[model samples]
Target: MRTEWSEFRESLRRWIYFRKVRFKRFLKARRAKQEDRLAKRNAPTLIPEGANIRQRADPRQSKIKRLRADFSNDLEETRFRFKQWKHFRWMRVRHFFQAVRTRLADMPSIIGFFKYLLHKRQRSIREQESLSTRKMEAKASSWSKFRSIYLPEWLRRWTIGGKPKSVLLAFLLLTSLVFVLAAYPAYGLLKALRAEQLLENSRELHQKGDLQGAFRKAHASYMLNSETLETFRWLCETAESINYHELLSWRQRLADHPDSGPQDRIKLVRTALDFHQPQVAEEAIRNLREQEVEPSEYLYLRLLTTLAHGRPAKNAAIRQCREILSLPAPPLEAYRIYWSLCLDSMDPRFGREAVNHMKQTAAASGAVGLAALRTLLQLPFEDEKKQRLYSKMLWEHPLAQRHDLLLSLRAVFFGHSLPETALRAALGKQYDRLDNTELQEVTSILNNLGFHENATDLLPTRTMASNKELWVEGLRARIGSDETKETEKVLMEQTPFTESERRFLHSLLLRKNKEFKKADEELVEALRMATASDLPILRKFVLLHEDKATLVALLHRLAKEPAMQRWAQALLILTLQRGAEDEPLEELLGAIQANDYRNNPETANRITRLKVLHGQDLVACRKIAEGLVARYPDVREYRFTLALCYQESDRPVESLRLLEGMLSANPSECPTQRLIGARALLRNGFSSEARELVVGFEKINLLAAERRILDYVLTQTKAKQKGPVLP
Candidate 1:
């Protein structure tokens, strides 16, 4: 059916071409007949005698008239043919058929092109085979010549027959087969070569600090030939190229190679970790364990990798390292690994468990294990239960001969009730057994816990030499309730109080039954000593006082005291208005102006009422505020204060402009700023924008007092709407 349709299309196309030619001939014949008819109609009678000419005409005149008549006939015929050709209805129909025929004729090429393509393919295969044979023959000849000349004596005995070229061809064919067999090997070598070249180049670039480019080249070599162990080795070496997936694949590949040495596998595992592929490193280490490699070394590498990946894997790493440490014939290195994992765990219970394990290990292993147990106990175990376990274990163990451990446990349970008796009980049995150092530790712990005389039982000679103030302070902590001490006095007569010493003394003084006068004297003495050392003791001094006079006097002294002067000056400005008697506001303001701390000058001015007061001196205060505002212009407080000062001194317009800038720059102006701004706007006769600003503030329902501002703005808005209430 397809073939018949195609033949019909070709025949239709030929018919269309034939009809087009026939139609052109018919049009030519029709136009010629029309021209003759027109010539007959337009011709003068006896035009054939026109060459004789008229009596008044010369010879050229007759020819001219004849030419004119002929030209008239030609023009008429041309017009008639042009009019007939305008529509050309038949040509349009023929063109449609021609397009159809042309489309149909092209269809065969489109439909059967695949079938015809087979013939071209056959020719290509034959051509290629012919070329391949010639190539094979040439290769054979070259190989034969190379083999004869270059092959060793034993290789020469392998007979190859026929003419040299035929023998050469056969020899070459065998040689080509050998090469084909060796293609993968050659590919492997080339890949290694490329990798080595890349590694060298990358090393140079890495030395030159082009890490990213070096990573790219090394990555390309790894991708191209990654089947062999060397490729894996290079991939491992170029750690930055080992992305998460490739690292996993290399780990799998390395695991497949059982012959891989422990050191090499370890190197690869480290490489995985360097690439941030902790999971792969973990898997490799596990594989090493399964292969009966040294568990201690690999487990440590895994533990370090897990930690480097962060705390999520810490528990698993701890478990694995513990397994290694638990081995009967464990590597000596496992002890350190176990110790490290314990340090990183941060769980108090784990520390206790570790100490418990150490206890057992020490009984079997001696002082080395006991020393490990002691180190474990030193980790910060804040929980009482954990400390109790540590103390109980130490008391039970024969190797735990150190009374210092029990005393350290007592220190851990100082104030809160954690069976200090139990620690004492344990130590009492071992009291005679302890060395002098252990006895001192026990004495100090007991003394600090306010069992001082009992501590004296442990070390009677040590009691007489202790610091009196420390002894007294410990007594206060152990005996006093806070209320009785609040009325008591504290003194620093014997030794100057450190900050912590002062805190303890302050708390001691605030306790019930403490002498108030003595405590007061102590606080003052402490502050004096603290000031000499440049302590910021004023804040503490203020916390202790209620009467404003004492605070003011202390602040005045502190402000000029040099050691605590700046902090004293700044705090005096902030807190003075709240407590201090009305000094000349100028004194406070003058101290602020002379102050060196620019970082918090705004804080100083805020407390001084600098922006609220109006005077010639207020200009200086405003200048400082403006300088601060200019520095941190985004700060609305500084800007708002400066703007308000401008308005208060009768520069209302400048104030309004400044307020507008502040509002535009920071639309979320606080309620205080909004209130100041609206007032400034009203005073500047910008009653409309002021009403808008006020209405905006009202919408937010900032404060109950803002209703008054809203009322005033509304009154002005209504008045303006009704017509201006002119002055």
Candidate 2:
């Protein structure tokens, strides 16, 4: 029943679909007929003609017969037209050939006419040339007759021999000689002047620390004036910072100069030593003694060369160094060697003597004190003797009248504390004022030592108001602060600083606000305008800024610069360091390593921090820290890091000794230093000392966080003292 119902439904559906199709077709035919009738109604002009819609055709044979007769008439007309066209074409061709034959018959006459015209023109040109030639002949004859007949024979002899006269030749030769002589000296005078100018420019460049530019100018100057010791000295100084072989070539030039004196030779030897060319220094010293250099100068050079080349100085050498130091006005280098000898021999007398001499010398730039501090830096923390000496020297730095400013800097560098008020007063003590130069001397020392806040404080009141550099430096030193008055004043012309420089300082302000895009754009402009001198200043901005976004922009700008590409790779690592995120730093380093990324102190420190933070590569971390400490002894952070590395390496004694130096250098950070120090001491089983060290902090005021560290140190020391045993 279900199948039968389905078939019935299908049959009904098919019948209904066909009926609808047929109904639609019928409506279409009716609509077409209605449209045709409407067309005839609208026209009403010959309605029957519109209704027919086509010409009528008869079915009878009469209509076919009429059509055939008309077709025959059309064919007869076409044949007649074709015959006429064929006849016309033959007549046209015959006329064209007749015209060509007529023209060919006239060709001989046309050629004769053209030849006649050409001969006529040639005859006219010849007639004109002959007339002009006769006039010239007449003029030449008349001039010759006047000279030979009217002038005296003696005068004619003189005129004939004019160019070859002996007296005239001698005078001409003398004039040529004068010009040659005068011109050579003039050329040399001008060249010498230009060379002197270039030398001055090179001197300024070297002072500005643009080694490549300095060398370029110096090389040009030397090419012009190689005979001068001054030019050679400048060239050597500039090239010493760059290529060593080039420096040696210039050093040889200096030594080979005719005017090179003993002082010049000694300067060469010193430069060679500075360039790490001991063989050059050795060769120089060997020849210097015979040049009658002062005995003391020779001895100091020998000792300096020996010490610089990793060779130990003998007792004889030490005695000779003492004699040099004892001179009325010894060389500055002797005191440095004295510090070295003092460290090697463990002699306190030598140390005290060197210290006293550095204190008394009013002209000293604090080199001896720095040298002493650096020597102590190289010793291991396990060497208690060096540790005690370093502390005593670092703390007891006597601020003599001359050494006040520089020694404070060294003190700050070693993490030694100086009273802000005292340092400010001392800076203004002389001349009852401070200039940017002196302020810079102190500020640079402090900033390079990582005592940036102290550097900011030391800027004199209202000093940045009148000083553009001091203002910009203050802005840099005051990173991450709310201070903008000086920045605004400089930009708005509310201060005496220059407009051009203050505009550059806008980048630091932007960096402080974390507007890295504007900061990077401004830095890019500065880089475009940056001379070699401006670049060192610009790189410091990248080093100071910490944002990943800021560094990313800097990396793009620097990467496009071929000279700064290596720096770009280093900055790439520095950028990853900011987020401290998902990407592994080691993998990034390995990828950058393929690009030949050179290590700088800044990038090395960043990598070391990342390694330590991730708890990876403990050995490499310590080694890098050691290098950083050695390279930047003034940076207290590197020293502290190195101390931590020592602790990690199980050298607790070394760690404590290292911490002790920082503890003395920065005693104001008492709680923090003492905490780390006590822990290291406790780690080494010096629990009693650690306890006393923590107890001593009771006299100092500490912040809450510092107090927590104090309590923690106390707890650790107590735990170590009691062990797991019951009291």
Candidate 3:
């Protein structure tokens, strides 16, 4: 049935083609005949004029005769054209059956012609294959010799018969074992290169303030190349910098590492407690128990483990300070750890007791006093005695350059003014002693605390030019505050800045100058080069230009790509949420809840946040936040959010306690914890501390609204305080 239908269709197409050809011939013949007839009709018809030479000479009779001849020629042409149209209209109908018959008669000839062509093509293909085989045999050169000697049975047929695919499978199978055995150096090099790349990404994440991601990548680098001392050291430092849980994984390994020393063991034990891993701390203590160690070191290890693990550990940590100081010679870490534990208690009794103990210790060694003072000064009280002690210690510890720097950093952290000499002196000494990450922290502290000049001076000169990360930071600062005359020139220099980012900045300038049309054009070009990092910026630009079409286009394009699908969904969700697109948003949420198989933590976080915010139910919000906190324990932001929910739910004490742990764990980071802690502190009547906390960020760049809130909080805290004014 199918074959018959196909033949019928072919017959119909042939009939149409034949009719067209016949019409062409018919038109050609008809036009030729018409031309001859028109020529005869149009030839001047000589008619005798009514009888006279006078009549022949008159112009009226001549004009009338010419008009008649012209009309006759036009009529003949019209009639001929009509006849041509009629013939064409009837051509298909009149020749249909005749065309079918002719096509049927030619079917055998058409089939025979195709068969002839097929035979010729087969002969040509055979000749080409023979010629190709001959060429392949000729071209089989040095590699064939190597193959025959090394894996003789594997590829013998390929070379022997000059036939491709003859023994490739066998070749691969035989070569696999040998290559695996021989490829270590090459594999090692590849791993080293990949580790370096991951380390660079870690640095980028560090700059972006994604501490979780940064440390994760840094650890990944170490995992890739565990033999590299630099990578291992980087993994340790990054973990320390962010107070990450990965420390738990590497703590025991580090202790067992050959390069670890006595000091490293003690520090690791203390860090374990700081990371809130009491079990690891206890294990370290036990591990040290079987080994020979100094009495003071053993005592301190026992002290840390006791302070970390029970309900009374807080009071235990405070009471142990006296015994810790009574030793013949205390470990230098003892002073700092004792006072830090005191401050972490957030109790007045512990603070005063720590101070009393500190006075006895401070007179003996300013270094020890400085260690105590460093944690003590962060107490946020305007105590006259603490000030007097700080001033006295400044003179007493004249040789303690690094400690003085620590004291200065504390002062700067509270936005206190420092003498130029003291600031530079302390920073210069710090530059010599600090690690790379610590230097970045100090620079950031100096910068955010409004000592921009000191911060600028503190940037590491050795790697500034070569480190792309540092260069980017310096470039941002320069672009933000370069000499006015050089702003355009600085913006025009495009190295290191992505094209999309550069154009985005340029578009901002255009927007500032009220060049709306030009700004939109620049943004369109920026959208063309938009990267994953630039997605949020692209969305903002699109929104600014009211370019809904551009965003929808992005959504569509990103949807088709597997790697980009996650981002596409996120962008659409954000856009829909912003626009209050409720129906589609609900649909999206339903789809995600119903069957999303990706299992991405980030996507889950966003969805949970979206749901919690939309529902606006405190109970539901707290429940979700708690779940998120438990599931994503390493994500500091989620923990902070959970703290926030606790605070909002009127569990101020719990919230403040959690904040204290986080702040003690990692003081340099944890901005979110600080904010929530400040508010909780105020509500709990620790207004002085809250004031100091909120005021600490005043000099740092903040949004206007945030600055206003900080000022308001400061005013309220100051109103509650009756202590001596700060100098």
Candidate 4:
């Protein structure tokens, strides 16, 4: 009964579904006909009406009439078309029932038909399932392939090698075979790379001018591979040369010296002096003296004299020399003492004395050297007649015959004609005829005496000559005085000196022709070049010669360079020094007083100096002093300078207060501080404080003047019973 109910429900659902589909088709057919007939009926006509203004109909009425006509035609067409479709649908329903009745009578055919339908449905389902399964299987196969391609070795081995022992062994054997096949090529490539590296090293050595090293390296590379010689060239040069390593070993042995003995130190010192390391030579002599061993007499004396003049020790060099000379030894070291006196003494008398002593020594030994005596005679004397005579003798001496003496004679006796032949004979007297410094002096003298043409002819053009300023001045004179334009032609043709020297040249040119603006610009440009080198001191010098407004702008520019900050500091100090008595300096002092960055002790001191010069009132001065002392406790001068400021302001009481504090803490520091303190206290009528400060000075040794001042202050204070004369 339940199966029969399900079958009847199925039949009812199909019947209702088919009938609803047929009804919808019928309604659509009727609506399409109505629309077509309405379109035909509303078609426009070709007939025309008479053009009478009175015959026009109302627009609303005409529209209503046309819509009614269209509605009537639609009604008629829809009714006729609906009847025709109704007849056709009735016949279709009649044929459908007749077919159903025939199917129901043949029960076996119906069952077989249903079975065939079921089989077709089952076959379709199976085909669809098979398609989906194949798609899923393909996706799984693709995933397995991707996992093998990108996964790590451990995972791949775990996944694939789990299959069988024989397969795993085969995989390992194949991997080993591949690695073995690649190893020989890798090893050969590494060997080739090493050989190329060695060849590169050899080439680098050759480029560095180490030709022998390059050759040895090349040969070593060739030993690795004979074919390397075809590419390398260093091997040829290294064939018969000594190896660098052997030479290096020999050098090392020469350098492996123990501490030098006294004689060795003396030799080293003399050698260092010859090499122009006077400071090092002096150090070496000191070391020799420390060893307490005697050097050769000549060498010892020479070291002592060079040390005295060139590189004096912390103590007085002359005193040290005199001590060395006083030693009781052979020849008595008097020759060294005499020569030192000649070099450093302000008189030629010592030079004469040196000559006398050397003569005595040489006479005692009968081998008195003309070199030492001639050196003494050549020394310039303060007395002109004596200098001329000595110069003449030096020029005439056989061994001491020097062009320097002839030039010196001419310079000393300017405007006095030397024999023209003698001057012509000394024509080629370049500076090499004299020592370095003497050459500089001669060039300067010659250029100063309007003898530049002669000086230029005498001086070398190849080497760095002395007296650059003189040369520049000579050029300017020629440009100013000479009419041939020779100097101007030379200037245009010649290369100019560096910025500083060129600046000097331009200054001379400007001074000669009175071209101030052009000269200033040239100097400014030189200054700019020097400033670019970050030399602040040079910038300051340039600013000093410039206008104040220009100087301010230059200082602003210089402030950008870190090196010029020191220059700015120095300029500030100098400006303060020059303008300390001015109102503007007081304003600057005020600004300094208000400054928070008092960490610069020099700026602080400069402020104090300006304050003292400005003569600030006692109150203003004390505040600044207290602030500075609080900020910079170690600045003892601030306190002392502050005391002077107070004393200058007629406030002896405040001055005494400042100085008393300084004297209490630093009694032994500045003797002047104590003296100022005693004087200030006694003047302010604080006799007790003055006496106390005076007693403290007795503990430390004071100069006679300081003691006298203190004594006068004490005597005056006692005599005045009430107070020192206060303002």
Index of the highest-lDDT prediction? 3
lDDT of 3 by residue, 1-727 (tens): 9999999999999999999999998997677667666765676645566555443332333333565689999999999999999999799777997899999999999999999999999999979966765675576776764563335544454456545573666666668878987798789889999999999999899889888898989989988988876677668778888776667667667777877666556767888777655656666776664366787778878777765533224455555655777888788877777776665553444667667776566666546666655544445557756665664565456565544554545554445445666665666755467766666666555544445445555565445544544444443333334322343465565445568866865665566456878877876787678677765544433443345545665574465467777658777776776555666665665555411422333444455544443433457556666765664464555656566677666788877665655543444233334666667667666777666656567656543333454665677776767433221
Q: Estimate each model's TM-score.
A: 0.29, 0.34, 0.31, 0.33
True-structure RMSD, every candidate: 42.0, 26.1, 25.0, 31.5
lDDT of residue 431 for candidate 3: 47
Top candidate (TM-score): 2
Can you list the residue pairs that collide in candidate 2? Answer: 415-665
The ten-residue window of minimal lDDT in model 3 covers: 593-602
lDDT of 4 by residue, 265-381 (tens): 554554444443444554555544533554345445453434433221212334444455556553434454446555644334345655565545432321124444444444544
Worst 10 residues of 4 by lDDT: 308-317
Ranking according to TM-score, highest score first? 2, 4, 3, 1
TM-score of 3: 0.31
TM-score-superior candidate, 1 or 4: 4
Q: Which residue runs does candidate 1 get wrong by more than 4 Å? A: 1-480, 483-552, 578-586, 591-616, 661-675, 678-682, 685-727
Candidate 4 regions off by >4 Å?
Answer: 1-259, 263-292, 295-315, 324-384, 415-419, 427-453, 456-489, 494-504, 512-518, 530-727
| Residue 705 accuracy (lDDT) in model 3 | 31
What is the overall TM-score of model 1 with all chains considered together?
0.29
For 363-426, candidate 1 gives per-residue lDDT tens digits of 4455555555555455556676766665555555567654545544554555544364655465
